[model samples]
Target: MTIEQMKRNARDKIINEIAFLAGGLTSACQVRAIICAYLYVDLVSDAEYREYCDLILQVENKRISQSDF
Candidate 1:
């Protein structure tokens, strides 16, 4: 599949996982957790896009790891 397709799939998976987790819990913590998961997915998508661009640049450069950045 294409990069864009992969990104969409990843996002859908993240949302499904978050929904499952949220379904098991109650109160404000659930909302917080869902928000965090959403943000995490967004970051993942952004990082993927950045890396794609970096590759297109065709220059040797170090990019921060997702866990570290």
Candidate 2:
């Protein structure tokens, strides 16, 4: 695969795993925290980084359901 495709695949795999592990309310919060820690660096593009941050925010804020993943 191309470099960009590989990056997307990696991102998708991590996100999907996080979403899967967030099956309950408590686990959902934990997932948010884990994702925050995992993304502590500022290497990726602003928009790409914000997408994941926003997703966790929605989960933490109960604006979206974990099953939506």
Candidate 3:
């Protein structure tokens, strides 16, 4: 699959795992384990992750500013 497709699939899997944790079918320890596994599979470096995080924060700030007006 393409990079975009892989990202989407990874995101979906993470969401599902979080939901399972929330539902108590999975323990907190299990959730942490899964998160570690996901992080390893993510492959993105710290710099790339930081850049994407900053972009998301910027978008969120802009949305909040617009809503306040």
Candidate 4:
């Protein structure tokens, strides 16, 4: 997939898992770490991986409140 697509996929995956992620501690860090690690391997270079990480972090930090549910 393209870099933008990859970024979007990562963001979506994180958002989807956020609700079931368990106490916002384990999954927030663990899943993001796993995804970023995988992106590091899958991307062409560190730069792309870094961008993916940034994008993923932004997604992970998005505010979701009880009312949104």
Candidate 5:
């Protein structure tokens, strides 16, 4: 698979796993913090990065249900 495709797969898995973490709410917040920092010095294009970031935000904000994953 292409690198972008691989990244998407990893992103999906990470986000989903974080959503269901032992203490999901706390984990989600921690992940969101990392995403914010990782945005800099990262190779992903803004659009790709946004997709991943959006998922975390949606989960933390309760805009999307973790069960939806």
Candidate 6:
């Protein structure tokens, strides 16, 4: 799959897992760590992986915000 596809798939997987695992109460650090575990340490470059994690973090944070209300 292309990078965009990978990113989308990763986002979906992470969000779903986080929602189910913690009922949308997970922290940013836990999200970041989960991203690292999913992205693969050696295959994906550090900078690119960080960018992907950042993107996912934004989405996850939005979920957290919505859940608060």
- For 8-69, candidate 6 gives per-residue lDDT tens digits of 67777666755643455566667667677766734345775777566666667677688799
- Top-TM-score structure, candidate number: 3
Per-residue error (Å), model 6, residue 54: 0.6
Candidate with the greatest lDDT versus the true structure = 6
For candidate 2, lDDT tens digit of each residue in 1-69? Answer: 776775666577557755664444345556555455445643345576578667766655563454467
**Candidate 6: segments with Cα more than 4 A from true spot:** 1-41
lDDT of each: 0.45, 0.58, 0.55, 0.57, 0.60, 0.66
- The worst-scoring run of ten residues by lDDT in candidate 2 lies at 35-44
TM-score of each: 0.38, 0.48, 0.51, 0.38, 0.43, 0.43
lDDT of 3 by residue, 2-69 (tens): 87787677556645755565454654455445445656777344554455445444544555577688
**Which residue ranges in model 1 land beyond 4 Å of their true spot?**
25-43, 46-69
Among residues 3 or more apart in sequence or in different chains, the pairs in candidate 1 whose N, CA or C atoms overlap within 3 Å are: none
Q: What is candidate 1's TM-score against the reference?
A: 0.38
Between prediction 2 and prediction 4, the one with superior TM-score is 2
Worst 10 residues of 5 by lDDT: 36-45
lDDT, residue 69, candidate 1: 66
For each candidate in turn, give its C-alpha RMSD to the true structure in angstroms. 14.5, 5.6, 8.7, 6.4, 5.8, 5.3
Candidate 1 lDDT over 1-69, as tens digits, reads 876676677556545544443344333344335445545656355565444334323221222233246
Model 6 clash count equals 0
